[model samples]
Target chain A: MKKHRLLTALAVVALIGLLGVFNLTFDSYKLRILNLCGIYIILGLSMNLINGFTGLFSLGHAGFMAVGAYVSALLTMSPELKDTVFYAVPIHPFVKAMSAPFPIALLLGGIAAGIVGGVIAAPILRLKDDYLAIATLGFSEIIRVVATNLQSITNGPLGLKGIDRVVNTGWSWGLAILTVYFIKKLMDGSYGKAILAIREDEIAAEAMGVNLFRHKMYSFIIGAFFAGIGGGLLAHMLGTIDPLMFRFILTFNILLIVVLGGIGSITGTVISACVVTSMMEVLRFLEGKMDFGFFQIQGIPGMRMVVFSALLMIVILWYPRGLMGTKEFNWDYILQRKYLNIFNKKKKKKTVSEEN
Target chain B: MTILNVDNITMQFGGIKAVSDLKMEINEREIVGLIGPNGAGKTTAFNMITGVYKPTLGNVYFNDKNITGIKPHEITKLGIARTFQNIRLFKELSVLDNVLIANHLRLKSGIVASIVKTPNYKKEERHIYEKSLQLLEDVGLLDLINERADNLPYGKQRRLEIARALATEPKLLLLDEPAAGMNPQESLELMEFIREIRDKYEIAILMIEHHMQVIMGVCEKIYVLDYGITIAEGSPENIQNNPKVIEAYLGVD
Candidate 1:
């Protein structure tokens, strides 16, 4: 049953990829939107790994993403001296190879993020929910604060620019699919069960022989790795970068996606990321388009966030479980009634023979 | 052969000594009971031996290795597993998944292998699931495999905890207050279940129980403890009649 569900999920993902590829166009704006969706998918999946699967309350995802964005930008740049790859730690030859091209760069960005995540998580992951949230939130702020201050490497507050724009919609969608697939494989595995076990009860999981610290660290690192890769992809799409872009507000935006999408459900995250991404675009038109009696107001970006945060609050109040609430896609969910009949008939035959 | 030796272990909470210099040993395939009044440090001894708490002063030896301060998971991997005093099953997970998670340390695949879905990983994952199912069936919880553990009846929940601990394939099983909430009929049924599992698995059982009916019924030999000290150690009949055991349970005559 597990095998069948996994194969069908893979097939559905491949079909979506084929459809997106066939419908591809030359317009940079549409391409950019698709690419952004992919990045959000990675961010959503990464957040799911930490908060959804591992049950750690982390608000510092943007910190790891910033780390990924900076490092990946440094590695993938064309080696010009102007605020680009200067005094750069000699990235191993293989790392440059892995990240130079569009697709490999996302993976490299994720791995680099994973390394940073491991380091940050080592000291603070041991903390409980609220403490972890504070620690992770502080970590993200520290990354942004330090990035803004250090003029030598990140050009201080101005940020790195002229990064090669290699990330296209195809790469974005492909990596998004890969992220979803990899997360699917994990949440269905023995380790996934172990993590869910930890989430349900930590003391019980330990007595059951699950190494809680190991599982906790694994989930955080993986989550951070993907968050970093997502940031890297986002940087490439923009074709320009600044430390100010990855603020705490950005972290909260991703948090909104994970919470609304249903914490543990990958399918829920993909759909919600697309929906949330488009909501931002539609809300932008409200600034100048709507006329007030006394004042004509252009759509301010901050207004949209106020609305988003309110909606996020409403969703949490309404559905406390956050979408799926530990439910995984099973064969029953995927199978149509006609196909289910096939299995039912076979089971009936076995039962009849046993009675005879 | 001696599978576990609790040598002069003491457990203290602040100023309260829960178990003071308690000593016990269990050979392979033995069924021993730790019984006394409600707060006689019976569970405390089991907790110290299982690495839930570091002994105030003494050591725990399992298979000749000093396992006093090892982490709970390490102790489990070293062939010891336990159930909680108050039925601490992973409540939100399915009954089957609860056992399957317990069996994780036995799986051949590691993190990378599981994520990559290699051929070996598939085979190993299948093996672990099958083994988990078998353990559930042994505990007669196969039908409720898909149900959430917290939804189970009190008696079934206790059985599920035991099945889960068994899934770790421990050489010694420590059950703390297994029959704490059961009535007479249910408690009697649990008595049979405990003995049957011990006989079937060929594993030693060390239990901390307040129920005399279960202690007298299931244990081959028993140890009585009070104020962190062992008061009596003998066969079931001897323990039931001993002055220290009686006084500990009731009061000085």
Candidate 2:
């Protein structure tokens, strides 16, 4: 427990290091991208809990993120924007009367998204494999469609524009750290084992006394909650909102993060999220500038994704166990310095102790 | 009072009757064996008892309470644990985690207690891990505590499965062909292990084993099933000489 707290503290200090140690504008940009990556790490880890660990397929992450985004937006949006955004007086006449600070609004948004995820998961999580994947895809579309059609709230696709810019690099990084820390703690807990067992084998998990429905639902909703938080962070980062932002491709990007990181590995996911997010952001510099001699071709929109998907396919096909293969970054792996030292240490210790 | 009474339990899968009017009584701490040939409805009967399937024509009573069609996990929590014919350990998890998962059935922590990980929850979690480790020790698997379950050998995997089920702290344990794929030596060792577990733990065992030696040597009482029906019920000596049991086994051959 002391180790957990200490790690959390160090993570927070590292998060602050991005802003404190470097004062250059480049540092701000790096921090911004890193902050977004931090959110993605949280999002990716939650999805791993559901799809990777519980062996359930869900594509409704965007839906939960949308819920969090909208809930937080509604709570935090300046009164002037809300007046122009909503066609009807807010459903809660009294709630419409008041607005909160950005942090409170974001927290409320996370809680609301959690509730939404829980309710939806109760029914949608009942499905598995292709059925589950399809159901959750339908759920994401449902959320998207609702956000588009419901002009009374969510600004009906035009989205809440000129929104608050309180979600800077510092807040995003803090949340990312908190999210990963809590997830790691949970994974080490007993409930985490139940979820992992289900993924390894559901029928066996059930017979072993795991409440199959409950664990499946738990993973589904928790993953969704963090994805929702990530959405809130994204909204804050862009300082703008649009319905198109919550599209399937955005969901695909997070999935790519998990795939690159390795399924069921926390540390791997964090590193992958950081690497992928930065690479994508940096690759944006190449957009529409390449001029090939054969056809005068330029970098097209979504080109980076093509490369990313290609990389994802190769990684999955060539190394199905992933970069980390289901192993966590525990003290053993760290002390061993990636297993080399551990192997030698074990051999030396065994032989030396025997001789002694 | 009968702890578990199967009153003419019959199960049907479309046109086939998997188990038909199979009546049995399992009192506390009685090591009973259900022996039969392949597809002899022994697994079907065991499944019905463990609530894997709803019986076609009868009801099962536990502690004088009807538990004819409750969910499998609920039945486990009701003090009945089981092992499968095919070894079904959680392949990705460590052996300790395999046993710790079974402890989930007993954890009374609510969602809030878990997410925040309150003091009470930490205490409960630690206690459960200690208990899980103890169960591993009981099965002589403590040394391979951190090994992935799928990496264990055939015999050890079977033993680990038993240890996982035992972690549920069951009153009645249903073993589905506990000696199915073992060699003669492994099977004999298993027979002794089964007796030792039953006697040492004082837990009732209802095993569905095809090995005659296991039933004859260890089980105090025997039940035989063929074509989804209980054809014979007696002591090992009676089952050995019973013309009906021998004819059933020979006829199938």
* Interface RMSD for all numbered candidates: 0.9, 1.1
- Candidate 2 per-residue lDDT over residues A1-356, each given as its tens digit: 57766865785677577555543555667767766776787788878777777778778888888888888777777676677666543434544566778887787777777888888888876677899888888888888899888776666767777667777666776787788878877777888888888888887788878888988777777887787787777777777777787888877888887778888888778888888998998878556667666666565898877778788888899878667777776654454585787788899999999999
The C-alpha TM-scores of every prediction are 0.90, 0.93
Residue A81 in candidate 2, Cα distance off native in Å:
2.4
Q: TM-score for the second chain in candidate 2?
A: 0.96
lDDT of 2 at B215: 77
Q: Report, in order, each candidate's fnat.
A: 0.92, 0.78
TM-score of 1: 0.90
**Model 2 alpha-carbon miss at residue B235, Å:** 0.9
lDDT tens digits by residue: candidate 1, B1-253:
9989988988889999998888888999998998877788877787788788989899999999999999988999999999989888888888988888988988778899998899999998888889888898999988999998999999999999999999899999999999988999999998889889988999999988888888888888898887778899999999877987778778884
Kindly state the fnat score of candidate 1.
Answer: 0.92
The DockQ values of the predictions, listed in order, are 0.78, 0.75
Candidate 1 CAPRI-style tier: medium
User: What residue runs in model 2 are displaced by over 4 Å at the alpha carbon?
Assistant: A1-15, A22-28, A85-95, A291-295, A338-356
